[model samples]
Target: MPVLVKDYTWSETDTEVLITVPLKGVKPSKADIFSSEDYVKINYTPYLFEVFLYAPVVEEESSIRVGNGVVEMRLCKKEKVIWGQLESNIKMDKEEMRRKREDVVKAVQEKMEQEQMERATKKREAEKLAIKQQMQLEEEAHSKIEKEKQDERDKAMEELEEWKQHKQEETKTTSITNKPTIQPAQLKQQQNSKLSHNMWQDNKDIPDSQRPAPRSGGKITVNFTPRYFPTAARESTEKEEQEWLAKMAAARKIQAGTPSEINKNNPMLLKDKACGFFKAGDYEAAINAFSQAISLNPMLPVLYSNRAACYLKLNDNEKCIQDATRALELLYPVVPSNHIQRAKVFVRRGTAYANIGNHGLALQDYEAAEKLDPDNTQLQTDIVQIRNLISCDS
Candidate 1:
């Protein structure tokens, strides 16, 4: 009799093979599973599933469980060897089985191709949308800056008008208070002199090339020195001299020491300097700066994490692990431990561990990072690669 099969899924680990077959409305007690060193068979009244193993398995170690309308079998391999494919030969009509296999392979290939094309199309659409949004944001930012410039110009013009009005008011008050009883000719002469002085003062700011040329007849030169002194200096006495001496002493004190000193205890300043060194790719300088920042502010986990990154760049795996661990310890009290910063620290530590050939610790850290950033495809890939490495090593 020919063996029948049902809808199923199968997977393998380094030492075991697992198969899940849907039993659909069948009771667990109604299922029967049989196993040998090279084959597994399952029957549940209206359904059956069977597979011939490509390699030998421990029949005594094989086990089956039925739950939630499904039967799962776990077969332990006798030898720890990687299987290229799962199934062996089946006792079916040779030509019919060949045609069935070809049809299945073609269907699977077409489905995979369709899925790849769909993914490509979605990726292109996402990229186009992101570009469009970025362009819109840039245009809005430019428009905002232009509007701010226009507002500044308007404010300057308003201030100028206000100043002119204040000056005019001052001039009117002076004319009303000093209304002298003079003849029209004298008044006209005074007005002419004032107008000429105003014109000269205004033209003084203009460049010599842009100003109007003087008449060719003669040149005028005038020089005057005022006999005036500041009130503070003019009234200097014993008390003033004492105050001046005290001020000079204070100035000397500042010049002699304080001005040349730097406040190394400022954590924020140290952090800023560290970030600058990091951007410049000076890993050693960045590490020193971050170390100072951490000393000044030991509670800041980011400083430790940043120092760990610098150590990573310097290939100091031990220091990297130490700093990363310190950062995690500091971050433990934070409410949200799964932040991106924490995730980055985990990744850094995982990389350091992996570099030292400690795949077990690296896998643990990678798994933790994956929980923090589940959508990070690179982290997922790292996890898979680490698992494969562990399996190969085992």
Candidate 2:
């Protein structure tokens, strides 16, 4: 649609021209004004106004103002002379107005094309950047995969070398074992003959006091004899067995009453003792104490968990998992089921699985623990590490 030109009035002085348009409620900033030395154009929404000046004006010295629902412009004249009229004498007929409108439309179209070109350039650059980032990420992933494969190859080579060395040692052992054996009596005879020969050769150097005395007739006598012993009487065996059986029975009676007497029906004391042993790095003793405590109170989940920790310290991964699982099972359907204690059990089980090289199961348990306690940074780190291990294994 063609814009409606708004009515405007203008007055001129010796050095300036003042133009005013009544807007009623519109702000002057809403108008777009294009000014030059000979022509001026004012455009607002649904309104376009233009005029040819009577003479050239200083375009840079023009000013616009808006107040009281009125928009005004002050155009400073280049020459200090009064203008006969606000506009030029040349009339703007229909053809000239159409030409001016077409010129304005062309200028606006050129500006819009320039802006669109700039936007297209920015978009292409952004896409290129995104593609570059994706390629970088892919390269990093490929490098990581290659590194893991190399590590596996190196590990395999090490294991193969170890096996080869072990086989070589076994071969040496077998060869040694296949050699002929000497009888003890022959070996003793050889040693005695060697000793006699050496003694005869060194007889002249021997001291008289250290040497064996010789008979005056130069005759030697030798004797070989076997030792004999008296057999034992059979009467003492029955009495010894009877005394041993009595002592064992008494020990069993004491053992049966010791736990009840020392613990006095309190399992916490046993738990404390187990913890003390654990703190002292005596895992075997700690495990025994924990087992005893668990036997005393089967429902104590902490006992099982503590025992699982001890098992882990001992490198018994299967027992660790079993005890951790038992602890979790005992803790269920209670207030502590989803508490930090239960989460710790899951972490313990996960650690055991990790130690046994079961990355998938370890990841699962770590994730479960993470859900129970999301703020645990260590658990999160463990989960990521296990995931990486699983991926590498695959």
Candidate 3:
């Protein structure tokens, strides 16, 4: 229904008998009023005035109506109006039609532009989500590949370890079959040089002056010879067996007390544990464990000697000498029965004494160890060096 009509201007330089239609709560659409040809038709005719209208202002409580020489009009969802009769044939008012068309056109163009912006925003969001999913998938694949590689490495290491154990067993069996049971001292002396000093092998053939100086002092000199034991005679066999058993015991002690496994079952376990710690290159741990072990079992000379070794490794000569002196006090009297053990403690203590510049005490320990174990290569070597030092000092 027609509501009100008012005069309006489409442009500053253009005028017409104008009409505006108010939609109230309803917005007017271009599809309801105009066609595709209307825009082309409007652009070609400048005689018709242009018009601008807004989207329906539904929230406004009141409406407006005004009339000048130009006519302003209002229309609702339910209304249509007729303009005053055209001046020519029964025809449309070009100005009135243009005004109506332009209003609808502007609204449609704005709506299309808004829809395009929303579409572009949705597309960008989708692209970002796709990139995030792809990255997550790649990370999962990489993690799986890494797990597989690590599994392969672990399997290879296990197989290699098993093969090594098999070879070691075969070597042990072959060596046992080829060699008869030998005297422990004879076997030990031969093996000790290889285990205790690899450097000696390289320089063993070299003359005295050509060899490096002994770390304790004086010159380095060594002598080696193979000795035969009587395996046929019963007394000789018993002596050989006893000597062999002692050598085996010593070997077991050395192996068991290595840094990898300290014999906790033994009273000397704590000391051995400390020695192990020192071999593992953790001097502080070795020292503390050794001290604790000594506290736990003070009567054992081995514990004191072992702790002394740790102190020596740490370059704490005073503590080393103290431990060695303690070991000597406990061990010296029993040398007739336990010469090898006493000799080892003496040599170690003497080394500590030498480090502190007490040549006399160092010499004394060296001499004592030598007297107890006259055939011990290590003790003999040490005695020769002490004698050389005495000669040099004199």
Candidate 4:
């Protein structure tokens, strides 16, 4: 059951009443508030606050401000007279409260639906605009390609005309008798070049200058960006955003000092830091902290024992067993002062063994812990459980 909030403060003027509800550890964005002419409510998960107004107020004019671990509300009173109380003294039973809750919930859900519709409409408009721009860009690219082809054809025609004129002039100036004796390899190269020129020139139906050009040989590889979206690279923040996220992940990683600097700080402090991390449910960070503590002082049995608990939480059964055994070894010659810790070490090791399907070894370790702490009911329970497991296996 949620505890009722009765300790809230209120002040009233002739035409306004201000109420402040202290809600510790509550964020403003997460708190849900509903206000009507005669009702005011604030729901912050486990905590719920509601009040029936002593006098009717203008709900639309009223305002609520949440900040600094408190929710402040100002109600605009309809009447000019000062009210005796901020809320009605009459207490509401469960049925009345339930109806009020349902009413406010319906209103909130309706408001949320309207907001979702607005967002969807905006998204559709944006998508349509993007599609139109992309289509326009594709059309422009098609026209540009056609223009480039025309320009290349004109350039080829000019080059072919210049070549024909040069060949005619060379023929008129030279004679076969004046030609030098050519090597067989050179004569064959000239014959191949003449055959290639004639092949394009042999198209008599089309004008010589207008003949189709043969493309140069060799592969031309073109690479395009691998993207799921059609957005241009210059318009996207994907690369920068990814780099920022990578940096944030790196910053959150656990970092331990080098072995040479492990002894610089107090072992107790390092152990405390490890315990804090373990309590916060960061098992990986706790393990790193525990290792640093162990490197500073390996003789401390408690350090190894605590690190074992972290390993157990992470489900590293073999490492848990190793740490627990190391702790037990360091806690030699069981005495009155260390009996509790010794039993704890035995329990941890036994639990690790039980996890790894070694019921026989688990039973042995539990029995040892029972001898150290005879009154430990939990330890006795574990002993019984191991015995039952061993019996079932046999």
Candidate 5:
């Protein structure tokens, strides 16, 4: 059942109607607005609002705006007349209203998908046209240079024929000082023309710095911050866990840990099996076991944190970062109860980030963990190392 929203305001002009609905604690992205020429609806979780308009509106020209915790619709009236009421008195039963909303929603969704496809098609066509123009420009530049060379070749051939004729005529004369010969200055001018033509073509191809750069994208990395346990989260248990984790920071300690008490409903047995593989140095098997445990109990943050240790041992920093980050997210809200676990995950993820040359992000995680376990000298050292790495990069 939806809570019908009664708090809405509306005003009308001769040609348009402006309707505004204020939704407390609701963002525009979270609100789903559906509309047709005769109907409008707003669905934001428990809050729901819908209306069957008294008169028809031009749905194509109607516009919606959302800002500052309110959704406003400027509906273009089909007839230039003010309506007595916003909604029609004709009431709809639950099933009828459901059918109407469903039909309208389907139509709206189909239109959105069609528009997206059209936009994508247009984008691809534009890219093809742009590349084609670049190719034509380059080809024209090459053709011009070739034509310049051919004209120079014809001029040189004519000059050679004239020289041959002159030499033939001068064969019978001892004094040949007045013969028409190609001058050095003429040769230099021809050379300059060819050089300038070639240079122009060379300049037609833009330098790398002047041209637009290729589009690029960066990797998305998630980092979670642990809560600062000022009063010692979980007291003695938290202290002991933090100390143990600090000792095993390098992940070299392989322990034959005790198994959890067996219960038919308990999933710890699966986790214990993964830990056993981890202890025996069968990291791949441990990872598979951990994955199985995660599939069974994905809400357990410990499973991801444990699997992250195995990934780190295998020198797979990327996987380590992913698992560690997931573990921290599972331990969200950063309360005192989860402070210890969250800190451990933060340290593990920080180490993974450091391994992958993301010292700045690693430092961020380390600093968050430090607030939770201020007495841990190892955490302080890790933080210092990350800071040093960051400074070196700068």
Candidate 6:
């Protein structure tokens, strides 16, 4: 019997082998998967661009040859290009992507460091400035305190001289008008007053700039003189009274004093002078005047409160609080109806609290003030701003 032989060209599109049996020698009805006489070489489409074929098992030759069709391909293999130029372009693209990633990371790191350094520099500068400002304020306050002490001393000496001169004139007039007793104590007091007056005149000649500055280094020094306590009796004599009244009328022609129609010729004129000093930002002088006023009339809350305000401006928060507290203690229980007075102190305390960053305390004071004076637009605004700030911080 004879057998038929067929030849087939390898095709990339072929999937499986097609088998046929001959009707000739040793015909079997079944196909065998592994038999030397019953075998076929099958071709399959390559999965990717490259693959490796395994060598076929054979008995005759020492070395074997594998088929050329691809069986396996590397996972990294890409679509094959017509020319090598496309491969170079892909490699350049990969490098550029890597460079871009590195550049982005570097830029981010540099930006972060720059921001940190800038923040640190700002913090340092702010701290230094705060310290410098604090020191300057302290020096100013100290200077103001010292200057005020000197002014008080001079003013006292002036008052003593005036009293002595008045007393001496009285003694001389008495000696001429009636029998006089030259009391030794009176003589000594008179001599002392004259000496003090001369010393005061000398001190007055010293320019304020040449004089010692305030101990607290503040801009203003307060020197208060006690207004006449046992108010001096009016000098009698129709001629002299008319002359005095004429002089007072002339004085009123200039800038008039407040507390309207206050007697300009009264011995308490020093009180008004002190008020003027307070207005001039001379806390030392203001404080002195307030002290004298308080000494003469301890019932006045305005005097203490005014001094406290000056203390606050001088940055003497402790004294400010104390004086304000005293004013409130005196005024609150006695005059519960005084809203404006209490509001003023509350505003002062609130400012102190805000300056120290105690927003909670400041808020309390502001709220209290708002309750007392609902119509005060400025107070309403302050309360709103403070509440907003506290909310933000929290």
lDDT of each: 0.69, 0.69, 0.53, 0.72, 0.71, 0.51
Model 2 regions more than 4 Å off: 1-260, 263-265, 334-338
lDDT of 1 by residue, 22-48 (tens): 877876755666556676667666677
RMSD of each: 24.4, 37.0, 42.9, 22.7, 23.0, 38.8
Clashing pairs for model 1 are none
* Backbone clash numbers for all candidates listed: 0, 0, 11, 0, 0, 27
**CA deviation > 4 Å runs, candidate 3:** 1-267
Q: In candidate 3, what are the lDDT values of residues 1-394, reduced to their tens digit? A: 2322123222211212223433333312110122121121111111222233222212122223432322233222111333332122312466866666566455544454455456656876998998798778777767776776677666655654565577568667777567555577656555653554354555454322222222222232332222234344543545545664554355335422344543343345455455545544456877787676655556666777877877776668888888888877765335134677778788877887877778788989888888888887877887678778878888
Models 1 onward score TM values of 0.34, 0.34, 0.32, 0.39, 0.44, 0.31
What residue runs in model 1 are displaced by over 4 Å at the alpha carbon?
1-263
Residues 119-190, model 5: lDDT tens digits:
656876998998798778777767776776777667655654565466557566745576456578766665
Which lDDT value does model 2 have at 151? 72
Model 6 residue 256 CA deviation (Å) reads 24
Candidate 2 at residue 9, lDDT? 84
Model 5 misplaced stretches (Cα beyond 4 Å): 175-394
**Residue pairs of candidate 4 with colliding backbone atoms:** none
Candidate 1: worst 10 consecutive residues by lDDT? 207-216
Badly placed stretches (over 4 Å) of model 6 are: 1-271, 334-337
Winning candidate number (TM-score)? 5
lDDT of 4 by residue, 1-394 (tens): 7666788999999989999998868666456666777778776766878898888898778899999999999989998998887766444566776776567545644554455456656876998998898778777767676776677677666777776677668768989588556678766666565556664556465433333334354332333334433446677656644554454345334335565654235565566656655644456877897897777667777889999998887669899999999888766544445678988888888888988999988888889989988988977887787888889999
Q: Predictions ranked by lDDT, top down?
A: 4, 5, 1, 2, 3, 6
Q: What's the ranking of the predictions by TM-score, best on top?
A: 5, 4, 1, 2, 3, 6
